[model samples]
Target chain A: MESKPISLMILDIVSILLLAVSTYLALVFAPLEAAMGAVQRVFYFHVATAWVGMLGFIAAGITGIVYLATKDLKWDIIEVAAVEISLVFFLITIVLGSIWARPVWNTWWTWDPRLTTAAIIELYYLAYFMLRQGIEEPGRRANFGAVYALLGAPTIPLTFMAIRLFRTIHPVVVGSESAEAQGGFNMTADMRTAFFFALFAFTVIFIDLLWNRIRLGNLQQKLEQLKLNILE
Target chain B: MSAQREKDQKPSAGFLNSVLAVARKDLAAELRSPELLLAMLVFALLAIFIFNFALDLEPALRSRVTSGVLWTTFAFSGTLGLNRSMAVEKENGCLDGLLLAPVDRAAIYFGKAISNLLFLLLLEVVVIPVYSLLYGINLFNPGLLLVVLLGSVGYIAVGTLLSGMAVQARTRDVLLPILQFPIILPMLIASIKASDGFLTGVGLEDAVPWIILLIIYDVIFLAIALMVFDYVVEE
Candidate 1:
């Protein structure tokens, strides 16, 4: 058995530590929001998770392209890892989003632009995983996955823009829009600290998870090679 | 290596000629059978009827809902045509033959896309008139037709590419829509909005943004599809 690299072990510990600090800051240090009260705390994790999901999504797309260009199984490993991680993080983001929404929007979900786009992307990547599953040949699987991810690059952005062309009610957390009017809240000093900390913590955690997933992918590839060798 | 040598030795065909040749090949084959088109046409008509009844769209509400109904029908029927179109290639060894030819992969993609676009246009031509006659709506507006053209271009651009991938899968039949609908959602939204605008007499100005969106999507996806199509069809 291959040992986990020292850097990865370090990353694992650091990620846990950062996550602990970020949670403390978000749940306790952060001032309670004025309007939405306790429910509003969900925003800190929601945005951070969505950000991590976005990172993994883009990473998968890029690695997909790189896989095609180089025809390297290594890139394929990275691509799948990115995709799997992205899928889980995106699901969390959606659930966290719904938890935040149920109280504020008075419904579990709304068909607003961002909300709609987010949900559609979740489904889209789910299909991506399915597409990869239907093929047994590793090379063909990699090729298709890469192509699909590349396709997502334009499709996802276009989906967002297309929905925006209709209308948007998803609150702009950072912009000048009155948060009270839109059921969003601008951050105070402590909240800002928490928000930024959460973002940093999640970024570290994302990297940790991604590295672990990629290691698993590499091991799976090796196992497949071993099985092939036995068959031969 | 020998194939590359053979490709280089042959007289060069114009890029457009190869693209047209591929599209013509698909057209000729489809015309000979005519079943795919007939099926799409029938399926579209059925969707329109089903929606008309299902939505309980009375005469007063018909105009408002017409564009939605038409696009939904097109989307569903378009799926059928796209699946059949690519699945045929995979079945008859046509895709391999096409790949062996010295044509650029983009030409094949464009050719298939163009033929798919034509099939959709043909379906629209027949469906729109039937829909108009059935509903007593004057559906022959220039703006709406323009939107349809642009929308179909964007849609077929993505569909042909995804369907190419889907047809290779074991679950090819079900995979196309799953892989396609989300990606195609934007084009569908813009097309429906633009069509609705034109049908409602909102003036070209109001529909202009959607039309632009359609064109932009068409251009962007076509470029992306063209670039990645080689990867899709590779051994």
Candidate 2:
């Protein structure tokens, strides 16, 4: 491996330290809900990961657009970096949400709008990778991947709205009619602080990971180009 | 490199005409053979039959589950038809012929999209009546038809574009569905919601938003597909 830059090393260290601090705050500093206890603490990291996931998602779409507009291979690398990190973070977010849901909602899964949207977004990212995997030429792979990424943008919001509307029309029935509001709980000031801090921490982590991934993509591109040059 | 010079020699308008001509040829061929349509229709029917036994849905349960079943069958059959259509083009060198045409790249995209939409709509129309007969459910609601149309349009619009790319891959046969299902999930969900709304006697007001969502999806994706089709088709 090539020697890493000092700034990148520092950013990586800072990311790990912040992630540790965020976990500490979420697990111990935040107050627990009366109904759910310790499991409710999962909400902080869950929301934070989701926040970063959305950031990556939107960034991928924007980079996709840029790639299409300028036909820039660099933007394609950036897009893939954002999407891969988003996929991993979103998976964690979904798992964490499920863990939290087990205690709070008394079920490990809910077809709730936000959760459903996250799941769809996860699938979208998966499809993005699959599209890239199928092509032999790097340029074609980047172009097709960029196209599909842009195509998926509107559908994500529509998916959220569809589930939301479906829920509103046919609320999840569990014995009583009005008891459907139990999933949401009020957050205390300390919980809010932890929650916001987790978001901030995850954002930093997302950026750091994205930059590393982009560098890795560049390295891979360089190796491919070198191999082509040696062959010719 | 020579292809560009050949393209430049022709008037752009003539190039567009040739693209439409290619679309027309596909449509006319499908009209004649009817094999594609017949296959899709029968596959859809088989899917519904399997679902009938699979779910064991009663009259009351069927009302809610019908949307899911219908969309599921449509999705699978849609992918099947998309694969066959694109694979045929690729196999016969029709796609390469189109690529060699002096037309805008988007012309190829639209041509495929139009023909794909035709096959999907044809199957949907046939399947609806069969579904009504099989289940004793009246599916003649105009609102329901509108939702079906919008959903198929959105589904096929993306399906056609993606399948073009998928057909070029090593895993051409299997890759289309794997790529299609996730991207089209929103359309499936939205269509299911709207179709269920119509089936259960829900008014237009209830289904309108889903239909609108489908329209917006179709338009946005169509634009994106047009913009990037050049890249996918580039040599």
Candidate 3:
């Protein structure tokens, strides 16, 4: 692995600081959502992490395209990094959403399009890793991984659209006389500020994590090559 | 001279012949042993039984559960046939032989996909009769059968491609289903909705959109898998 540049190291620290400030802003500066109490506080981190999760998925897809075109191992490494970070962030988002949902909706899970799509996307990448782990040849692994990643990308959006279309056509009548009742909430200006800033903060955090993860990937590859050379 | 000729003109029936030969070979092999088709059939029946016992509802209540049960059976048993079909080819070293043939990779993909779809459809055809008998619900709706065909086509399209890649991995046996189920969710959902609509006496107007979505998904992924198969099989 290459030596850590001073700028990346500084960026790492800045991300941590920003995350802390963002949490504080979410916890303190932002007012609690009136209808939902303390649980609403989880929304800031939830959306932030989900934002990064999405960013990671899109990044991995783009890197998959680039890797296929260039036939480069470096892009494969970047793809893995983006996928791993996104997987963890999406897990956090799901958990936080579940926790928040418990109090608000009285259910741990819902068939909402985005949540279901997130779960499916998470599974898609899990399959991605499993696919990578099975191949013994590095070149074949890189090629197969790139191909699978590219193939999996289209299904994610289609899955999202299918669910949305299904829901829209058949509205769920959940104990409501008024038609305006199925899980829709209006956001105040203050809530919007906190929400958007959390997204911004998480974007920074995602870049930092992606950088570290890619560096770790590089280190692992170098060590493997070194081991091969020493054996020879 | 051969390289120049090859570049200038396609390989006529040689390529298509190899593809058809491979497909015919697989079909004949399965016909003799019948292990792949039988296993998928038994698995689909077992799944329907499990769903029946698991739900433990009256016959009157079974209509609502029929679509879900039918699709689940198809999905699970389809995965079985897919994994076994590819695993057999890999174990016998035939996959490598197929790759060595003078055929376009897309031809191999289509050939495998068609055979896999055949296996799935065979199982589904039998499962419907067994399910209707067991649950005492009618399963002969034309629209429902249409959904079955379209859904299985989409499922097998992606499944055959992924199973090809999965069979090459170290975790070959267990990896196919893990890789397939998540990616196939859209097809599953669309199929279920369309099938449910038909089974419950809903209009074709209600089901056309989901069918359109299925057609779009099948076309897009078929193109993607076709394009990517070369990469997957490349040395």
Candidate 4:
């Protein structure tokens, strides 16, 4: 069996330390918002997590194209890792957005374009997984998955546009302030520090998680190959 | 109409003939059986009843949400038709036969999509009248009809490709909606909102944006289906 790579080990340690520092910066170092109170702190993590979700989104698109062009299974494994990670991060982004919205928007949910698109994106990820799972052959599975990923890539923008149009055409029923997302404040220096640090920290964490996931996928593929050999 | 004339066409003309031939094959098959259309109609009519009772759609609420109720029926029954349409081809070994033909795979896609669209439109032609009669809501507006045409086009475009892929999977019957609903939500949203605008006499200006959205969605997905159908149906 191959040992874990030293570079990955270093990344894992760095991610943990960065996360600890990031959380401290967000929770304590950042001054409280004058408007929405303490719940505003969730924005730091919320945006960061959303950023990671976008990474997954972009990764899924590139891997899909790369797989289709190259017809390689390796890209499919990487696609799955990117999707799984994006799925979890998107869920976190939604929950955190909801938490912030509860106090700020005075409701648990708002059909804001960005958040609604994120929700739809989560559905796309699950559908991708389900589509992959229903097929047994890796080659065909990857083909179908790659096709869906490519077809779905443009829909993120389309969904946002459609939903935003809907909001404009029909009144939100939830009054103007919440409806228009007019409830945010300009960040001071302290908040800016926390914000940038959170983004920086989460990027490292996302990279570390993606690397580990790709390693596991490769290992799983190897195991499947070994089982086939043993049976033969 | 003869084989000689069809063979005498240009490349693009041959492509059209191939598309029409495949479409004609499907239409002829459906005409012979008629079960797919009948089932979709019955399912859609039943959905109207369910939505009516479920919403207790009073005159006031009826006018407001009739577009939603109508599209909801179409969306559900549309999925039914899409699933059955592909599944029938797969089940009868007709899909393999189609693939073996000397034609572009995208022609196959357009052919399937066209037949599917016809069934959906025919279903709507009946259901809308029946629904309006049942609820006393006037639904014969031209704008709404235009919305229906574009909406079903958008639906069938991607739905055909997705169902083509779904029908090959082990859990194909259930896999399609899971795969389809989210992707088509934007299209549905556009369609429903546009229909609502027209139905309520909100004027052309109100519905144009949504109509544009539908057109954009249909064009993009049509192009996508053309590009990706080969992969979905590849052996």
DockQ of every model listed?
A: 0.86, 0.62, 0.79, 0.76
Worst 10 residues of 1 chain B by lDDT: B1-10
lDDT of each: 0.89, 0.83, 0.83, 0.88
Where model 3 places Cα greater than 4 Å from the true spot, the runs are A166-188, B1-15
lDDT of 4 by residue, B119-162 (tens): 99999999999998999998999999999999999899989999
Pairs of colliding residues, candidate 2? none
Candidate 2 per-residue lDDT over residues A174-215, each given as its tens digit: 234444456566678888888888988999999899999999
Question: Which ten residues in a row are the worst by lDDT in model 3 chain A?
Answer: A168-177
How are the candidates ranked when ordered by DockQ, highest leading? Answer: 1, 3, 4, 2
**Which DockQ value does candidate 1 get?**
0.86
Which candidate would rank higher by TM-score, 1 or 3? 1
Which portions of model 4 show Cα errors greater than 4 Å? Answer: A168-179, B1-10
Give the CAPRI rating of model 3: medium
Q: Is the docking of candidate 1 incorrect, acceptable, medium or high quality?
A: high
* Clashes in predicted model 3: 2
Model 3 lDDT, residue B100, Cα:
69
Error of 1 at A50 (Å): 0.6
Q: Candidate 2 regions off by >4 Å?
A: A168-180, B1-16
What C-alpha lDDT, on a 0 to 100 scale, does residue A210 get in candidate 1?
Answer: 90
Candidate 3 lDDT score relative to the true structure: 0.83
